[model samples]
Target: MKIVVLNGSPDSRRFELDCYLAELEGLLETRGHVVKSFELRAMNIGHCTGCWGCWVKTPGECVIRDDSQKVCRAAINSDLLLFASPVIMGFTSAVLKKISDRLIPLLHPYFEIDRGEIHHRKRYERYPAVGLLLERATDTDEEDLELIRDIYARMALDFKSELKFTGLTGNPAEEAADALDRL
Candidate 1:
């Protein structure tokens, strides 16, 4: 499987997270999966303009020519998408949200009639399974976990992908790797 991990924490190379991700990458490689990682802090990704250009004017492309297009391409090419972030204010980091906003072009604009009922179209070509890793300090870990789960649930609905596994309050990278291994 080709896995694309997005490190959305502002602290791209933060010690614990980095170590975890490294371990996870090695484990995945050992399991015959290629991993590609994107650190949001290192990329010059602009906020989404909500221009709907990708849907209206251009198809499957964004107007803002930046790191987002690369990220989206990676997402499209990957079999699994891992979203790793440090909990901020009981939610995902703003960096993740920004990337997600730019990814709006990947989703359908309105509803599709699957069996006579209106439903959003599946966003990805294969509906790549998602793994969420939420890192936080000791006391607030549980709360942050719940908040993160809720956030991802909403995201899953929007993206029409399944939230396969969630790792919270543990070593970010290792826990995430373990979750992926279970998949």
Candidate 2:
């Protein structure tokens, strides 16, 4: 399996989330899965300006020529796309959200009925299964986790995929790897 990890933790120092991802990456690689991780803080990725240019002028591509293009390509080509971040103020970091918003180019401008709800059509024939790996802050609670999960589930649906896994840094990396292997 090929996996792409979008590391949205903004802190440069040694953080818990980064450590968890390092271990997870190693385990996955050892298990014969190719892993590609994009450290969002280190990359040059601009915020999505809500310009319909990606949908109109340039179909299936973001008009903004930035590192997000690499991210979009890796995400669309991966078997699993994992969103890893530290929960800040009860949600994922802003950097993660920024890149997440930029992923809109992967979908077509047209809408299609899916599960009785209107969703954008897929620009690609297949999209990666989505997963969430969160490092909880001191103030994080169950409600926050649930809300994040709900949002990502909807995001997966919008991407024409499914949310395959959700794990926390509190768990061992081996546990997370095992869960991913099951997927």
> Which candidate comes out best when scored by lDDT?
2
Q: Highest TM-score: which candidate? A: 2
Predicted structure 2: lDDT: 0.95
Which parts of model 2 are misplaced by more than 4 Å?
A: none
Q: What is the per-residue lDDT of model 2 for residues 45-92, given as tens digits with 9 covering 90 to 100?
A: 999999989999998898899999999999999999999999999999
Cα lDDT, all candidates: 0.78, 0.95
Error of 2 at 19 (Å): 0.9
Error of 2 at 167 (Å): 0.3
Poorest 10 consecutive residues by lDDT, candidate 2: 11-20
> What is the TM-score of each predicted model, taking all chains together?
0.87, 0.98
Q: Residue by residue across 112-177, what tens digits does model 1's lDDT show?
A: 875465667765666667878767755565666887788786677667677888875464555556
lDDT of 2 at 132: 99
Candidate 2 residue 10 C-alpha distance from true site, Å: 0.7
Residue 9: error of model 2 in Å? 0.3
